[model samples]
Target: MKSGPDDLAIHQKIQISRRTAGLLLGSCLVRPAKVLASADPLTNKIVVRSQLSAGDPGRLMNVFAKAYRGEPITLGVIGGSITVGAFATTKENSYAGRLLTWWRQQFPRCEVRMVNAGVGGTGSMYGALRAGKDLLSNTPDFVVIEFAVNDNWTDGEAFEGLVRQILAQPNLPAVLLLFMMWEKGGNDQEMQANVGAHYQLPMVSFRDALWPEMAAGRLNWSDYIVDTVHPTDAGHAAAARFITAMCNNARHADLAGRSGATSSLPSPLHSDAFEHIDWRDAAALDPHENQGWHLDFDDKGVAAWNAAAAAGRIAFDWSGTGLVAVFADPLLDPRRIRFRIDGASFQTLDTLKQPKRPILVLAQDLTPGRHIVELVDDDGGSGRAAGQQVRLIGIAGIGLKDDWRR
Candidate 1:
């Protein structure tokens, strides 16, 4: 019998199209077996590093207790979907959920309460904005930040703001930055490392370790990631394993033996540079039915696009005539789209004109360079559909290049 899209595998494939899938890959679905190393009773002191550097001979015993088995320590986790476990079937199955479970098991006597503060598509700007209420309000003993995957655009200035908010808590919470990844763009790990060192904090680079593991058979990339960007249940488990291992190692360090010296850790691995964009709703552009305009091809599936159809290109470019548009047919609120670019902003061919329908203008006259562009609904305004009112078909453009065709 032939299988249909209703198959479990097929459904999993469809789920990967969302941004949530990418961030939630490394939770706790795949639990790696623990290898207990014999404890060293003589080891007492450990040298603690101010940041992500190699440290003194510290004992991981206490860390293991604190992270997994210690008393009812309240851990507050904040970030985008990764912390929320978007791909996971439920919140209880998320990394945060699993970590709390492991903490309970590791320290049977301890009570663990986890506060999850994750909002999809939000950046550090949003993280900082909500820290007081979402994170600090609970007075957590420790906080973990995982904005690396969702907010690579966060810079030193943003880091300062985030740090200030996190430090404002009365407990002087221990902060852990877990650097995550996307398919491409700016070195997100680098950004995390810089921020971590500036704050003299502990940092974990899943991207740094996972890239090499994916290359080796020790770990399966497919088990962890559904796409180049997101992770599968297996992938999330792999992430959980990495975090567990790191925590285990930290606990095993002999912190009592170290007098008081600190070391510097290397910056997290850098990713390719990406043109940063702050999503916004733009006035609709003219929808032309000109013969010159035609839909083109796009590898990334068009979900929140102006229109979607396999028969035609989901996007288009005008042939040097200087204009084009993906008109809002049904007129949905929060009508938004993505336009990838390599350099600066491009010229808005229809800057002077505004159409009755909703649309976003992705210009082509800005920085001259390579760029991948896509349009997505910014989750802003709202409207209903009238039997496919939006059109992704190519309408018109003034001076577009031949290479711009689908």
Candidate 2:
């Protein structure tokens, strides 16, 4: 709600074009009348609802100051399906894409790169594990974090861990936490908001911006949400507007004499087990022994291992306490694999119920040292149905003691 003259000017300049308004109404699953009629009712309320967290103009001011100087920068977006543009007709209609467009318009002379690291159906748990390889590899200058809908109270530790990891980066990237809502009013915004307060980071809640209008009958759920979870193209536009307002507000913030804080690893609010995780595809492993295993190339251009028959196995040495096996979860019957660590008892992981890019933890928190791992085919002679097969895609490990080759 706090605003200055610059903020007002920025708001006045944000004009939603007729074509975008048409897209909002035309692409809606509901009737056009129901969406367009109520659109203006929530216009002013949107900006009022978007508030700066306890920490206004934190590191964001520094990023904007740099952009004002026309320096090239990279912005990274990391989250669940919403960040992945699930229900949006095209990538350009997604909130991330729209935000990039607005950024280009604001700083026409500066070069900006976009890095989207969203994975559908995954929460901050996997995001923290993959942040180093997937997102930070680009060395972004700013990062937008959105997992309020996907992360629950139980995952607060992982969520905070992700924040700490990003803040710990050498680049000292400006961080923004975004809270997206669900159709039935389900999300963990409060839990995430508490984490944001702990770190003094900026946060914007779409639920706060849109839900009140919906409850008061000024806006309907059909006006934005596509399904019960994902947002429609119009919904994405609204989200992009909220984020754009946030950035504009940041651009005009007063950070004249404040000294920026140094980037360092802070005391963790939750378990930071995934801070040093690394992933290696099956083809990347240097197997000391292999039997009955064949290299199968997938349509995605990934080389994976297929167990031709039972008892097929592969072995390797790793130096991590925690280990995770990544596999392709098919719709039909899937193959099973038995894993043994340091010659311990074998544990079988069934791929039948693991839908779409399933990852199972093989081991964790062992004494930090070199350990042997063996994987064996455990299909159990149950002949797969037609077009059913088990595939091993990759393995990821956390708390590695030594530098591992990719």
Candidate 3:
């Protein structure tokens, strides 16, 4: 695999914390391991394996046969916009659709049923609620859960809730957690896998698997994403390739025998920040490196306004970031709508800070690299502080660098 990102120091910290590191590494290196004790007919004692090397495509046909054994295999995909085929121009172009095509070719003699159960703007908490209808109702043989982009929308409670709901299913279907991305660099990979481990389920981390390829000038973010979170046609194809490879390697637990661009994550992942977030194990991320726009409320006191608070400020700085997206809401200031990113001057934009309404800000063509950003509120003459509750949603990081765009 290409050398890990330029941030070796950060992964070094992860390597030092052996326990967390081991799990993180396992999450990446030995992805989708068989649970051994599953009750699901398709998975029961079957274990999904990983490979460190890329091999022939023929092996994948065998992997599919082993997993299906000629019986009708039903696959259910659950997640946010990506799984729902958001930007895919045609149904046949979606990752799910492409996967179905592969399944049809691989198992022409056996029946394969595939279904899409993705909802836009929903997090894992909502995913859990819909599990009964989207996943369990169909009694799928395999279920793929995609929720990396939506994790930041809800608290950890909701994430775990989704995991528990799926693992608790009586059918005990073989479950694969697909941790997708919003921008090229936005997911908490280590934390995601830790949660997947809670249910002893296998995972497919598109971010960790794809990042190095993007970094080495072999892949690019735009090739995959149409907008911020949605994947374009090329992105779907790349995802399909990864799925095909994963199915090809499911039978080998050890990396000794495999082929075709094996995933590059080190075995046993860990990180200090992921620990603070309550994740059991996680793929390492650079703690010092900053991507996208990082904004946090520095003030201890939140302005409690019964109406739109006349202007608010959360001092923030950016460092040569590119193509970043911003989200804000009045969970903290609603009424007087519009906000600004203050540099030496304020760049005013509409920040629909309404109570419960999510405001999204897209700032493309950033000044090449690292820069600082400060959040500014504009109360515009209308003194409507309406239940003053201005809050900061979050930021998503997307990379437009030529190397990342492959």
Candidate 4:
């Protein structure tokens, strides 16, 4: 709730603009002031700045109609830190929670279930790998995808692949693309916009709705943004407002009987090489030997391994052309591991740099076949020394063949 210098500057500019508007109107030199006050400024701006092209509601209208008649509906949200409610005081104050609240208010008679599948510091690459097990398992009737900021570190191909994977689900859920912004006004919303257009998905943009207000001094960045990237409680509320407004528009608009089916899916705008990705925890795989490793379970039921001693080996077989090893890269006193695939050259994965998050990946692309993978503790024969504790979390496979571990 502390206003920074930038907030002060914006406040001053807003006061000046208001004074000028009042003066111009007093002289009867401007349009009627009633027009400005007729609607909430933020809501009006959102409608005008909306980036929704191909405004077909598809099966979303049908789902809304069902909900209105007291049918059960599930809403799923997937993304990175923003979706995880990083800066929000609590998960209930996050945008996903706010949106769910609105849905409940709009359809009080319906049973609404919400699944928030958000992982911090990850992009579409990881999202694509985990969607099947994490988000799609809920069989959502409606899903909101928010990866604009996170996808900045990824390419359009990966982003498109994630979108396609969601759309291709057997449930044929109504998918909405949400583009969130950073405080410094940087995001990959435009890049993902191309993919949204290709699929004619309803796209809501927080940046498009709020950036203009911020620039014109009608809104201050500090009023909503908590940091350079994450949103505060008020910021999440604003995002929820924009998303709700978009959905309201879709509800009121004519549906034209368009079904949100994969049959209508257009050709991919970029390669969906990651469409077949799958994720598995290290503990889930049957290890060839326990050696110096032991499984540790977190409160959330996620399993990780502490390979504090050297020469720990765990072997598994997977049929995939490419593989990515996911592990814990601690911020303090990190460690390293030597990974060998089918007796290939040993590749050392060092966690010397501070990890932005607990999860990290070491990926490789190989020829398609059943391959053996082994991880060896490379702590220089020292056991749990200052920087010699390595933890293995999970692994993800890309373009896996039939014999791939399920």
Candidate 5:
């Protein structure tokens, strides 16, 4: 993370096509995250200078001013497993939970509300798809986004889209970018930092502080992580401190300078396709479509069609220039996922070779309008339909009717 936002690489001058713009401003939906709760034992305000990047504290000025006034404030966070408190002894021991504790300490008189919209094994694409419904619906005044460890695909288009979406919220929330790392020091923080720098958002990195220590044998990675990715209770505490310091930095920022954070949303930092999106899960499908579909949670308890081959002729309606579908995981064997737009020719998605939560872009650049989709359950017996073991997630579109596709 950098201390300035004047990166020559900020190429948001590129414009989004009119058709793509229309695809935005619709409703969307996706899985809900486990609410973040509990207390953090470490109360000391620790600011690791190396881990802190002031970026743009513009939006945060108002948040701190609100805290100083002892006014109520709302906070929202979106991220993957680590943000979900994975590997922590308890949800409260997760960094999110600890931050909740820290916020209370700084402004005891100000009531703080939090919405933890963290899901396991998901990334910016999923975050962008569901953020409106999951995180922004509550109208948070401050938001934290952590996807570096999970946004394995795309350079940063999806990440940029997610950031832009949050900034576009009416609340004008203060946004913070958080980057977590794997034990081996592998992560997408560098890629994600570009988006943070472009937006001049405050960023805190746990890897910068701990990774070198681990390399020098001064800090035992196992002491902070029981696995290669998820952090241990100690690890969560370590991360929470940097976040606390960043918050302090924002609180102490020049108020007059930060007042300008409300500048008009910039042009496409990358592609705006993800800027406005709508996600539809099985819950949004016609009840009659449930005939062949057996609704069941996956091993991780995420609601999905464990056996969609049983869901006969499922259907739904969407209006957009593009559409996509999310599947639970890679197919154990070669398979096909078949669907059609407006009853047009069937589009087939051969089973994904990607890892968990593989997505298939069903269609793109189609004429914008209300289009119905029909999904068939195929038993893989030399058939044109989707495979029998198909576990269908919900469908999504770029345009829709409803808050920007909730």
Candidate 6:
């Protein structure tokens, strides 16, 4: 894929020690913080009440009820650079972090857990595939999804599938959809809102609440937003305020402390292709590589195998269907890479195409079973005497039938 303005990748530090890297990878969340917004909240005509499209609040209210009972609650957030705290600097300064702080403040007695599963430069297609591995694995009691900026209108099914996957969790976690916006006003809310409505979910929009202030000259976009997509701390704080407003509604309006209400998930909006998806990070897979290949890290510090010659090789195993190979443009070179699934003939893919990320569906309908996959660098031969390259990031796939609905 080609790197451009849209790819506002949050490049994590790689030179840090393993201990520091573990925290960066979200192994363990830090303690409660006194982190505050860098600037004061601005006054505007935007209505917080109107910004919330309340669907069935049964599940959300349950979370509020549980918290009041002093029970533990886990909060999860997944998205792109914005959710990962791009321009906000630290996680504690992020909108997600601000939301977590607001939660602790509301219920001081309850123990709240946080899982920040945001990897920059990724959209819902990748989110759907990695949600299980990252967010759901923590068994969060409540989750916030904020992919509005990273994903486009065409990502409806993948986004819907991500929601279904989280809702289908055995623990019955509550899902909240959050919509962020661009400096000039653009987001995936219209398309994403369709999925939210179908499932009767609690949805909040920062754009609806704050865009008018920018458009009407009541608020300067430069003062809040960092660039085209990422937001400054004040921008993030404004968005956090919208989320807290919804949470407050869930606590007070969704029936003050009594909630045993149950709700069934609606049928699929498009296809349930992502409900059982899983991602195999390059680091965890420990792929075997040739001498011609050098190891690297993606923007998120996840392992990436960089091929420097045609003889470079990478081999790994992945199961089920909807198989995808995620390539990291470590060198940003327009090169070719070839691969084979289950010993099938090698299929060639040219890297760094114009618009999309180098995420390819190697096999969309593989037989539901384990499969062997291998990649051989298709750059110039080992003796080419050139160091140009391509990098293999991670591999993901949908699960098998016996793996349950999720």
lDDT of 4 by residue, 1-406 (tens): 2556744654454344334333322343135545755654554434435434423466577678778679999999999999988888887899999999999998999989899999988887778878888998888888889998886655686678788887888767888888888865678876776677667677777887688788889878988797788898988987887677656655654243435433556777876657767677766766755677888876777688777566778776766777766666542333356777788877665532324444444544677767778888756644365653566677777776556646
Report the error of model 3 at residue 95, Å.
1.3
Kindly report which residue stretches of model 2 are placed more than 4 angstroms away from their true locations once superposed: 1-39, 52-56, 152-154, 255-259, 330-335, 350-357, 381-383, 401-406
**Regions more than 4 Å wrong, model 3:** 1-68, 251-406
lDDT string for model 6 (58-112, tens) is: 7888888789899999999999888889999677778989999999988999999
Cα lDDT tens digits, model 3, 1-406, are: 1334533543443233333323333455433545522422212111122211122223233335445567777777888888898899898898888888887786787788887888777666446544665677887756677788876644454466555555445545555666667665677545555554434444555665555556676567787777777888877765665565555345332333434122222222221111111110011112232223233342543222121234454443333223222233323333243333435555544343212434232343455444444444555543333433344433322222332321
Which candidate do you rate higher for lDDT, 2 or 5?
Answer: 2
C-alpha local distance difference test of each model: 0.46, 0.71, 0.49, 0.71, 0.69, 0.71
- Which ten-residue region of model 4 has the weakest summed lDDT? 20-29
Clashes of 6: 0
Query: Which 10 consecutive residues of model 2 have the lowest summed lDDT?
Result: 13-22
- In candidate 5, what are the lDDT values of residues 321-405, reduced to their tens digit? 6777777765543344466777787755553334434666667677766667777655455432433366667767863434334
TM-score of 4: 0.80
Q: What is the lDDT of residue 252 in candidate 1?
A: 37
Residues 1-406, model 2: lDDT tens digits: 2456744443332222222322332333245445544655545436446543525455777777778889997999999999999999999899999988888887999998899999888778678777887899998888989998887534475688688778878768888888888866778876676667666676777887788878878778887897787888888888887776666555544334544454455566555656666667777777767888877888988777777777888876766677766656542333456778999988765532333445666677888767778988766656354555667777767666445533
lDDT of 2 at 396: 65
Q: Highest TM-score among the candidates is held by which one?
A: 4
TM-scores for candidates 1 onward, in order: 0.49, 0.79, 0.49, 0.80, 0.79, 0.78
Query: What are the RMSDs of all candidates, in order?
Result: 16.6, 8.9, 17.3, 8.7, 10.6, 11.1
